[model samples]
Target: DTAVSQTPKYLVTQMGNDKSIKCEQNLGHDTMYWYKQDSKKFLKIMFSYNNKELIINETVPNRFSPKSPDKAHLNLHINSLELGDSAVYFCASSQDADSPLHFGNGTRLTVT
Candidate 1:
């Protein structure tokens, strides 16, 4: 079984389009997170959910939304996608905030 899984491993679309990526984990983790990896390979935390409570990083834009239905799932929604939004989105989970995160393969979104 996969510890973490994210759907649509690749996404290709034009600017202004809307898209969503789904994620699920079987590791029984308490905290799940969404991370964006930019072209330079910098991974930045966008949002984190602990037991269904949301914690958004201040630097993240409003266009990016993260929803966790339960402890095992976290989904990402992007509205009015921009060229700058093209990056690899990774879904990760950890037993707690201090534990190491196990990441999904990543969903690479490309905007034209």
Candidate 2:
């Protein structure tokens, strides 16, 4: 029962609106991350946090921010969402970079 989970499997939103995606993991992993898979299926890391400390922010827009209150929970908040932000957002966790990630099914965000 300890697996990564994200809310709203699909989101159809209007541009400029703000939205938040919540994620939780039950695994004992110390690191949690946010990745975006574009329409082309290319996955890119957006944020990474280890033990509630953010360690990486990969050139993501300022409007997109990730918050991890605890090792098992990380939430993403986007302000003034844009059309270019449309993609599948996946929540993942792993022991470390060398370890394989356990990914959530993903939140398909469509910004109209």
Highest lDDT among the candidates is held by which one?
A: 2
| Global Cα RMSD, each model | 0.9, 0.9
Question: What 10-residue stretch in candidate 2 is worst by lDDT?
Answer: 1-10
Candidate 1 residue 79 Cα shift, in angstroms, is 0.3
Question: Residue 111 of model 1: what lDDT?
Answer: 99
Off by over 4 Å in 2: none
- Candidate 2 lDDT score at position 45: 95
lDDT of 1 by residue, 16-105 (tens): 999999999999999999999999999998888998889656488889888888889999999999999999999999999789999999
Tens digit of lDDT per residue, candidate 2, span 1-112? 7499999899999999999999999888999999999999999999999999999999998999898888899999999999999999999999987899999999999999
The CA lDDT at 83 in model 1 is 95
Estimate the TM-score of every prediction. 0.96, 0.96
| Backbone clash tally (model 2) | 0
How displaced is residue 47 in candidate 1, in Å? Answer: 0.6
